[model samples]
Target: MVAGGFSELGEEGRMLEAQVKARINGTGTRVIGPNTVGVLFPHSALNTALTPNDRIYYPGKGSVAFISQSGALGLLVMDSITEFGMGVSGFVNIGNRADVTEVEVLSMFMDDPNTRSIVLYLESISDGATFFSKAMEASLTKPVVMLKTGRSEESSRAASFHTGAMATDDRVLDGVLRQAGVICAYDEVELLDYGKVLAYQSPPSGDRIAVITTAGGVGVVTTDLLTTAHDGVRLRMAAFSPEEKAELRKYALPIASVNNPIDLTADGSSEAYA
Candidate 1:
C-alpha cells in the first residue's frame, strides 16, 4: 500500500499506477491501499489485498455492480448484501474519482453481461452533464439506484472532515438525476431497502398497487404515505373487480370494510404472502 503512494508517482497518474502495480504484485500481494480501495471481481476469486480480507459475501453471481466513493461504505455494503442473501458480480470504490468515476462505472456495467442493476452512493459530481448523460444511457439497459449524501450546508460541513471540502449542490444534482430516471434513496437504510426491491422486482408494469391490511389505521397511514406528494414517487391504488371483492370477503372480518387500501381486517395470515 505504501508503495502505491510514492512521490515517483507525480501526484495522480503515478499514484494510480503504483496502486494498480501493488494489486498486480503477489509478494506485495495483500496490499489494498496504494491509492484506492481495490476492486472485487467475484467470478475470478481474486483477493489480493495486504490484509487478505474476505468480507464481501456475494452468492450465485447476479448482475448488480455496486460503486461507491467511500471505501468503507463499499465494504459495509458488501456485508449488508451478503446478509440480505443477494449476490454481486463486481464492487468498486473509486476514491478521489481521479482514475474512475460513476459515469465510467455505469458505462462498464451496462455492457457487462452479468450486470442487470447498479447501485451508487455518491458524494459529489465532478461533471454533472457528462455523468447524467452516461447514466441515462446506462439506465436504458439497467436500473440505477443512487443515494446522494451531503445535500445540505450542514451535511457539507460534515463532508469537509473527509475530503476537506463542502460537496453539496442539492438542486442541480436532484434535477440532473430525475431528468435521467435515476431513483434516489434518502439514507443508508433506504438505499439498501429500495435498491434491493428494484434489484428483485421489475419496474411496475403499471403504477397501481393493491394494499390489503387488517388494521384500518395502518391502512390509512399507508395510503397517506403513498398519496402524499413527493419528487419521484406517484402511486395509485388499483381497483379490484366485484368477483375479487367477493373473494376478499372470505378473509375479511365480519364488519370489514374494503377500499383502495383494502382492509382484509382480521383474517390475513402469513400464508397469504406465501
Candidate 2:
C-alpha cells in the first residue's frame, strides 16, 4: 500500500499515479492508493490512518464496518461515533481508488462475521452495476447504509478533484440503491444514526412504529419522518386499541395528546412515561 502521494496535485500527479499502477501490474499485488489514509482494524489494534492516535479518536471493536472515499470525513466520523459509544469492526479510506475499490472492500466486510452492518461515504461509485450487485447481496445477509455526495453540479466538480471520482445522477442512483435493499443517508449525522441503529438493533418485524416524546413538535416531526417515507421506505404508525389509549391517558396529563404519537407536552414527567 502506498500511504500517500501526489494524486491530489493535478495533471502531472495523475501521470505519476499511472506509473505506480503500472509498476504493480502483473506482480499479483494490489495497491491501495498513491494517496490515502489507509485502513484501520480496531479488533487487531491495527491503525494505518495518517493522523497520530493522540491527535485523533478511533472507534472501538464491534460490528459496523465503515468505508469512506474522503479520509477527513472518515476521521471525523470515527471520532463522532466512537464518542457516541458506537463500536466499529473496521474502516477503509479509499483515496484515489487506484486498485483496491469499494466493491472489493464491500465483499470482504460482508463476509466478515464481526461485521453486522456496513456504512459507506462515497463521492462516486467506480462500477455501478457490480457495486449494486454486491451491495444487494450484502444487504440480504446484513444491513448496508450509504451516504454518497456529488448530487449537484458544484459538488460533482469538487468530487472530481477530491478523488478523481466521476459523478452519477443521484436521482437514478437513489432508486437503484433502494432496489438493492440499501439505505441512503444524506449527511454524516444520518449516516452515523442509521449505522448505529443497524449495528445494535435488529430490524423491526412489523410495519408499526410509535413515536413518544415530551415535546409536541418533536413528536410531530418524528411522525412525519416515520410516516412519510424515511429514505424512500415508508413507516406506519401503529394502531392503538381503545383500552390502550385509556390506559395511557390515565398516566399522562389532561393536556397530553394520547394519539399514535403520544405527546406528553412539555410538562411530561417520568411517571407519565411509566
Candidate 3:
C-alpha cells in the first residue's frame, strides 16, 4: 500500500501519481492509497497505517471491518474503538481510490469469515452501481452500515478538495441505500454504534415497538423518538388494541395506563410486567 500523500487536485501530484501507478501496472501489485493511512488487520498484527504508532491506539481483533475514505478520521476511529472497548477485524483506508475502491474492499470483507458486520465512512462513491450491487448482496448475509458525508453543497465542495472525490446527490443516495438494504448512520458515533449493535444483536423483524417505563415523562420522550423520523427511517409504536389492553389490565396494577407506552407506575410489580 502506498501510505504517502498525493495531491490529486494538483497538476504535479497527478503526474507523479500516474508515474507511480505505471511503475507497478503489470507486476500484480495492488495499491490501497495515495492519500490514505493504509490498512490494518488486528488479528494478523499487520499494519501499514501512515499514522504514528506511538501516539495512536489500535483496536483488537473482532467481527467488524471498518473502511474509511478519510485517513485521519480512520486513525481517530481506531482510537475511539479502543476507548469504547470494541475491536475490529480489519481497518482499511481507501484513499483517493486510485486503484482499490470502497466496493472492492467491501467485497473482500464480505468473503472474510471473521467479519460479521461492515461499516464505512464515505464522502463519495467511485462506482455507485457496483457499490450498490455488492452492498445488496453483502447485506443479505451480514449487516452493512454507512456514515456518508458531503450532503450539502458546501460539504460536497469540501470533500472534493479533500480527497478529489465526486459527490452524489443526497436524495438519490438515500433511495439507493434503501434498495441496497444497507443501514445509514447519521454521524460517526452512530456508525460505530450501529456496527456494534448489529454485530451483537439480531435485527428486529419489524419496526413495531412497545415502550415500557415507570416514569411517564421518559416513556413520552421514548415514544417521540420511536415516532420521529431519523435519516428517512421511522419506528412505529405498537398500538395496544382495546382487547389487548383489557387483557393486560386483567394482570396489571389498578392504576397502570395500558396504552402503547405502557406506564406501569412505580408501584407496579415486576411480575405484573411479566
Candidate 4:
C-alpha cells in the first residue's frame, strides 16, 4: 500500500517498516496513504490512517458528512467544526477526486443511514451538470451547505497559487449553486457560521426578517442593507404590524424612526432574543 504521496522504495522501505513496526508490532496492515490524515467513521470507530490514531476528542457522531477537495483544508475545517460543537458522521478529503468524485461521495452519503447533512468546500466544480444533478437529488433528502472559493478574478489567481487548479467563471457557478439550493458563504467566518447555523438551526419557513438593533443609526444601515439590490435577489421587507411598531418604541429614542430595523435606541438586552 502507498503511504502518503510516495510509494516505498529501497531506502524508504526500511524507514516505512521501522515506523509501522514501532506502532503496531510490525503488523500494520495495508494503508492507502502515509501522508494522508486518516478517515474517520465516527459512529463505527473505523479510522483508516497510519498516523497516531484515536478519536478521544471527536464530537458525537451524527448525520453530517464533510467532503473537501483539499485534504489539508479539510482537516482545518474538521478542527474548527469540532471546536464549534458540530457533529459529523464521516469525512472525506477527495484529493483531486481522482478515484472518488463528489458525486460518488455524495451518493454514498445519501444512502448512508447516519448522514443527515452535507458540508462541501470545493475550489473547483469538475463536472457542472453532473454535480448539479446529484446535488439536487441529495439536497431533497438532506441540506447541503457549501463554502466554495475561487470564484472572483483575484480569488481565482489565489486558488491557482495554492492548488494548481484552472479557475472557471464565478458567475455561472454562483447561478448553478443557487438553483441547486446550495447555500454559499462569502467569507471563512460566514462559511463556518452558516455551516453551524444550517446544521443546527431550522430553515426559515419564509424570508420575512425583523432586525432589532441597539441604535437608530444601526437600524438605518440595516434598512439600507435589506433594500440594497445585489445580484438578482432584492430584500423585500414586510410591513410592520401595529404591535411590532409599539414594541420598537419601548426601547427606541422618542425621535427614532420605527421601521423594519427596529432599533431599541441603545437599550436592548440579551432578553430581546426571541
Candidate 2 lDDT over 150-202, as tens digits, reads 99999999988877788799899989998998988889999998899999786
Clashing pairs in 1: 26-29, 30-49, 30-50, 31-50
Question: Which regions of candidate 3 deviate over 4 angstroms?
Answer: 1-8, 230-232, 246-253, 266-274
Return the number of clashes found in candidate 4: 8
Residue 237's lDDT within candidate 3 is 88
lDDT of 1 by residue, 70-143 (tens): 66777777778778787776777665554355677778888888777888977777577898898888877688
Per-candidate TM-score against the hidden true structure: 0.77, 0.89, 0.90, 0.72
Question: What's model 4's lDDT at 135?
Answer: 89
Report the lDDT tens digits of candidate 3 across residue range 142-204. 899999999999999999888877879998998899799998888998899888988888668
Supply every candidate's count of residue pairs whose N, Cα or C atoms clash at under 3 angstroms. 4, 0, 0, 8
For each candidate, the alpha-carbon lDDT, in order, equals 0.68, 0.87, 0.87, 0.66
lDDT score for residue 171 of model 1:
81
- In model 1, the worst 10-residue window by lDDT is 1-10
RMSD of 2: 2.5
Give the clash count for model 2: 0
Where does model 1 exceed 4 Å of error? 1-35, 48-60, 164-166, 230-232, 239-253, 269-274
Instruction: Show the colliding residue pairs in model 3.
Output: none
Candidate 4 regions with alpha-carbon error over 4 angstroms: 1-38, 49-59, 153-164, 217-235, 243-258, 269-274
Error of 4 at 234 (Å): 5.8
Q: Kindly give the stretch of ten consecutive residues in candidate 4 with the minimal lDDT sum.
A: 1-10
The TM-score obtained by model 4 is: 0.72
